[model samples]
Target: MNSVSTDLIIQSIYETLYMVSVSLLIGTLIGVPLGILLVITRANGIKPKRIFFTLLNGVINIVRSVPFIILLVAITPLTRLIAGQTYGSTAAIVPLVVYIAPFIARLVENSVLEVGPGIIELAKSLGASTFQTIRYFLMPEALGSLVLTMTTATIGLIGATAMAGTIGGGGIGSLAITYGYERFNTFVIILTVIILIIIVQIIQGIGNRLAKKLRHE
Candidate 1:
C-alpha cells in the first residue's frame, strides 16, 4: 500500500502539472492580447472605442464571475467536442484554459495600468506609434508586474486543476478524494496538502526571482 500510494502521488503530480502548464500557456497567449486590447480601447486609451471596450469587458466579466467548478461542468460538452471525450488531464486543460484566460487578461490589464500615465504621454510626445509605445515602453515597464500577474494566474490554475479532479480529471485532488477521504487515509490527505504547498512555494519562488531580475534589468 505504501508503494502504491507513492506511485499514485507521483503520477498525480505529473497529471496536475500537465493540466496547469498547458492551460497556463494557452491562457497567457490569448489573455495577454485581450488585456492589451482592453487597456487600449478604454476612454483614455491609445485608440478609445467605447462600444468595443464595453462589449469585450462585459464578456470578460461574465466569464470570470463563474465559479471554476461550475464552469468545469458547464463546459463539459464543449470539452468533449474539443478533446473528443472529456475526463483526463488533457481534456481538463480545455476548461482550465477557459477558466484562467479571463483571469489572466484582467491581471495583465492591471499590470499594464500600473505603468504611469506620464510614460505613455512621453511616448506619445515622441511620436511613437501605438505598437511601438506598447512594445518598447509599456510592456517593458510592466514586465515585472506581469511576471507577478502570471504567477498569480498560475496559482489559480493549480487550484482549478484540483477541482477538475472531482470529475475524473485525475490529479492529486482525485487521489485525495479517493484514497484520503473515501478510504479514511489521513496520511494521504496530509501528503497531498504538503505536496500542494511545495508546488505553490516553488512557483512563487521562481516568479519572485524572475520579477526581481526583470526589474533589475
Candidate 2:
C-alpha cells in the first residue's frame, strides 16, 4: 500500500516487459528462419535433406527437453559471459531467448506446415524458386497462423520470466517470492498474479484481432 511498494511493482513490471520484449524479438529473428529450415529440409519438403534436418531436429528437441530452471543454472557460465552477469533482467534474457527460440521455431514450423499442400505444389508448378515460394506463397498463406504462433510463444516467455525471477532475475516473480511468499503478503501475490493475467489477456486479444484481420485480407 505504501509508495515504495507501488514503485517496486512498477519497476518489476518494466523489467518483465523489457526481458520479454527483447527475448521475443531476438527469438523471432532466429526462430522463424530456423523453423522455415526445419520445414523445408524435412523428408517431404521442397528441398529435403534428411541428415541436416535430423541434426537440427535433434538439437531443438534436446534444448526443449531441458527444464527452464536447470537450463538457467546450466547456462550460467554462458549467460555471465554474454551479459557480464548471471542474474537480473538482462542476464535473464540470455536464457529466456535460448529457451524460447526453439519453442518459437517449433511453433513456426507447425504453422507453416499447416499451409495446404496444394498451394505449395501450385507454386512449385509455376517454377517458383524456394525463396520465392516461401516469400510469396508459404508466408502469405500462413500469416494468420504465424501471428497466433508468436502470440503463444510470447505468453510462454512471460511465464519463463517469472521462473527466471526465482534465480535473482528480478521481475514480478521475484517480487512475488520476496514479498508475497517470503513476507507472507497475500495481497502482493494476488496483485502480481492479476497483473500477469491482465497482460496475457491483452496480448491474446491483440493477437486474435490481428490474425482475424489478416485472415480476412
* Residue 127 lDDT in candidate 2: 97
**C-alpha lDDT of residue 120 in model 2:** 89
Candidate lDDT (C-alpha), each: 0.91, 0.92
> Per-residue lDDT of 33-105 in model 2, one digit per residue for the tens?
9999999999999999999999999999999999998999899999989999886889999999999999999
Angstrom error at residue 28, model 1: 0.5
Q: Which ten residues in a row have the lowest lDDT in candidate 1?
A: 1-10
Candidates in order, TM-scores: namely 0.96, 0.97
Best by lDDT: 2
Segments of candidate 2 deviating more than 4 angstroms: 2-4
- Per residue, candidate 1 scores C-alpha lDDT tens digits across 1-217 of 6424567778999999998999999999999999999999999999899999999999999999999989999998999999987877888989999999999999999999999999999999999999999999999999999999999999988888888886678887777778787788888888888889999999999999999999995
Residue clash pairs of candidate 2: none
